[model samples]
Target: MESYASSSARPDRAEPCPRSAVSHGVGLAGLAGLALWTVLAWRYGMDGPHAGIFASVVACGVPMLLWSLLVDRVHRRPSTGIDWSGPRRSAREGFDISVVKLAGLWATWGAIALFYGTARWYWDGGYSYAMQLFGWAVVPLLLASIPYVIWLDRYLIEPRDGAYAFGQWVIGGAAGKPPEGAIGDHLRAWGVKAFFLAFMLSITPANFANVIGWRTGDPLAGPVELANFLITILFMIDVSFATIGYMLTCKPLDAHIRSANPHMAGWIAALICYPPFVLMGNGGPLDYHRGTAEWDMWFAGNAAMLWIWGGLLVLLTAVYAWATVAFGLRFSNLTHRGIITHGPYRWTRHPAYLSKNLFWWLSVMPFLSTTGNWVDVVRNCTLLGITSAIYYWRARTEEQHLSEDPDYRAYHAWMERRGVVTRALAALTRWSGRGSPAAHPERG
Candidate 1:
């Protein structure tokens, strides 16, 4: 081992990165688990069968849980609402809390099930897979909730949360009703999970299958093929991490939803980007891909241009996926589990949104129509612009929600002052002798 004369003598430690809520260690733990699983799949000639695809949840979740609990000691955080030092709730009180929580939770699950059963789209295409997964999971989840809720309520700082309030309303009527907005809050939080979780699950199997069965043809035969394949891998990583996040939103992991977005605008902004409601989908109002050809097609026969363009597309996707990875097990939409200030987040508040929008613009090149019709070109470009505007709307509403948290506000300030993109733009403005307009703060 080598010794340093002083702290200043060590270049490696010269500048410490800004602290992030989710530690690099925890993210690495999840990545390591995922990497190991990938290695095993490749070694064993796996094709991402149903079992193998579902196993990804375990592959990513277990290691993250272990690291967060054993190493980071995340359970000790005040945000978790757990008080290990204090005596637990009384058996009777705990039972009461658990009972109400169970009532609320089971009712919520039932409602979600009813909604799924009635929704024609949920029964169609990829969503059918999510419905199947949820069907397979229901019994296990119902059986586990009883003991889990009881055990958790014993240590929660205050267990009479929205769920408990809803439960009270369900059983005790108006005489023992909770606050005015408690049930609404409970619904919004669960709604976020229910809507997004199903979508994540729906995409996960296909991505996993694509990645594990990535041996089709020579991927490197062309830049576009390689890029598509690589994008599949990045998407797999994003889906795997996001699936773990939605499933592991537990108090024990200190990743429970502290608050869901309260604004209808915020919910609307996010929900429209997802399935069954997405306006940007094929033939929807914002279907920009209608007249656009693939990026590879535009640069066909030009190996150099295709390679460069494909590489940029891949980079944008990597950033988008990195934004998810940075969340560790806290990557839910419309909820503030915690504020993260590292990884791609350090560069921008909404790296995923930014990069995804950029990817759509570059990859689709909406202005370039397959039919070479200026009319189609204008329509596609305009629609894609509106789609991007929706994302911007989402970012703003999310910022409005998270701005209430001091931690998020601090991160927002740091990004405004020291973010890589901010600094670069500042330099460019100065070089061009132009005054830079003030940019609004954002949240990750």
Candidate 2:
């Protein structure tokens, strides 16, 4: 709802700007400058808010400088043996950019513009209402989101490899050495798909849901419910963080990991995790359009199922966290890391995959309220099921990769021996307790 129109008084033209220019200009400005831009915008009386436009341009530039400084510092003391002089390297010798990199940069800005523009036009009624509604409620929520958005932008944008492909900082030396060409290739494929799908998917359900919820006349569901809804709306945060966490911990320990396989697994993982939310976002509105009363009933059922299944996913989170912490403490490097037999591994060979299935399973249940509506129901169920299958197959592929590694073979033998000894001892103890205490030399 914030006026995106740059005032004619501003010197800059409105033609599609490059990503670097926009990101640097906007980022340097920060939120405070953006606020000033708004005030200046008002002062110009909506005719030509040059002040606002200039302020915005100035603020965005700051981040570019900051980003450059960080990259220079990091690469200045490089240990990876990667030449800062690599052909793709920037003048600062900090980060490298590729055609895909440029594409990512431009695509992000374009997407943001498209989003705000579409929201301004299509969801006009709800946008105005929500602004007023939030005047009392959303202001504080928006204020809180300031830090969160800053964090998201910093991680998602500023760093080389940024959030899309890889993180810039190695952090406790915990990051795995991504397979050769993996970072660039991964970013190219993942970035394109994520950009397009997220833009198309985020607006429709989000606006529709907000509009419908506001229309419900339920005072109790005001800002609090809306806040909760907003968090879920950004479910990508959870999915993305979860993926990053998995990589930090699980990837290195995955003795089966091969350079090629991880990329494929990454794709499979994204397929399983991201697409459902998109389907859900767009589909939620369609279901609601059937009728408000029916929608509410269905929404409750769907929300319940989602919540229930989400609760189950807590188990996966724990596993990912444990692996991350363990790897961080024990071994500095993550790659060719030996397979772990403790924690969740002790229970099942593939706890992560099991967790992956649980994640999707929860996603499917929430829509059961609309089970009668075959399109929405079938569409989600089928994708959910298919993606889960893909994740399972990816897991098998990773296991195969491990099978060839010598370190992995050693760990496998150790685990097998440990398991046999422990199980036999337990059986002997049970037998002795029932009758006589017998020492079994064979078991020893």
Candidate 3:
């Protein structure tokens, strides 16, 4: 939320963003659904199988979808590009269009399948789990796409979106040409979905299993253990919502991607943070955990310090998860589905990144080596610094992408004027007699 300074105190305060497309209420609905599901699963010890974990997603998604449709009326939004009042085209006339659309859609899936097959990483490590998921989903998806395309085609104002355009190109004809760069845009969007969805699915099972399987006589016995347990639950929430996001990018719920990030830097910066490409993985270049112990280790005998530090870390982790919760079902990297200004987003634009980096620093003190080696300290700290720099780059590129949208520009302007971090930075900038930084921005 922007500052609430009255006119008497402040002369120039900008207006808030025009709309927060994702409602705070909708996120609460999802949270409610997930909480109910968590209770039942915990009671039954339904934590052994990945399938039950997948079902937890349904707990959240079903309610969110119902709330979005019945309460928020999201499907009626003009942004959805659906015109419910339009007269239907004759079945014969619409049949060809639907066929072409399905063709394009299937072709896109085929290309993704080929890529999955060719990519050695997909068959190995965590990605192998994602492949297993794809195996189960492909058939149902193929069958479902047929009716989905035909039904949606009837309402779309211009149904010949990226899939239709790409399909035309694949089929080869003059009709396939959809202005310039349309096909490129289509491919870029799919590329984003393919890459990130796998990563999300790949980790969901493991993380969900960990959270549900966490059994202890009293996990709350110690402050540090209680904090850890709570943080794990938060991460579980983040994972479930994020997976729901990648899965629900469709118009019916008004959560379709308006555009994927067109910038290469955005893609590279995001991809490097996950899976086989992750630079911070074990033995990777940015592995900063080489000679460090948990932050609590330093305060082992000091109960007060341990509790204080643990509470701080848990708070940061909650902030990180709250950022994901704000996204509801539209969260994804390298894509702009819509502008969101609720939940943790009210304080700063990048709550997840800020809180996440803070948690890492406080939790690992990676610079303080257990071996008392200066080289380890410098290497670890420098590497972690670079990791943060990459997040900064990722943030700038996201802002650059979202800048194309006037609403986001308005939101950015509002943040510059009233956001806690942005306003503070501006004051510091003016105090130092240098203007606020450009292309470099901060969020909660």
lDDT of 1 by residue, 260-306 (tens): 99988998998888878889999888889987898888999999998
| Global lDDT of each candidate | 0.80, 0.35, 0.79
- Total residue pair clashes for candidate 1: 0
Q: Which candidate tops lDDT?
A: 1
lDDT of 2 at 325: 28
Whose TM-score is higher: candidate 2's or candidate 3's? 3
RMSD of each: 5.7, 19.1, 3.3
Q: Write the per-residue lDDT of candidate 3 for residues 401-437, one digit (tens) a residue.
A: 9988888887776656555555565567679987744
Instruction: Estimate the TM-score for candidate 3.
Output: 0.93
Q: What is candidate 2's TM-score against the reference?
A: 0.32
- Higher lDDT: candidate 1 or 2? 1
Error of 1 at 5 (Å): 39
Give, for candidate 3, the lowest lDDT window spanning 10 residues.
Answer: 1-10
Q: Which ten residues in a row have the lowest lDDT in candidate 2?
A: 1-10
Ranking by TM-score: 3, 1, 2
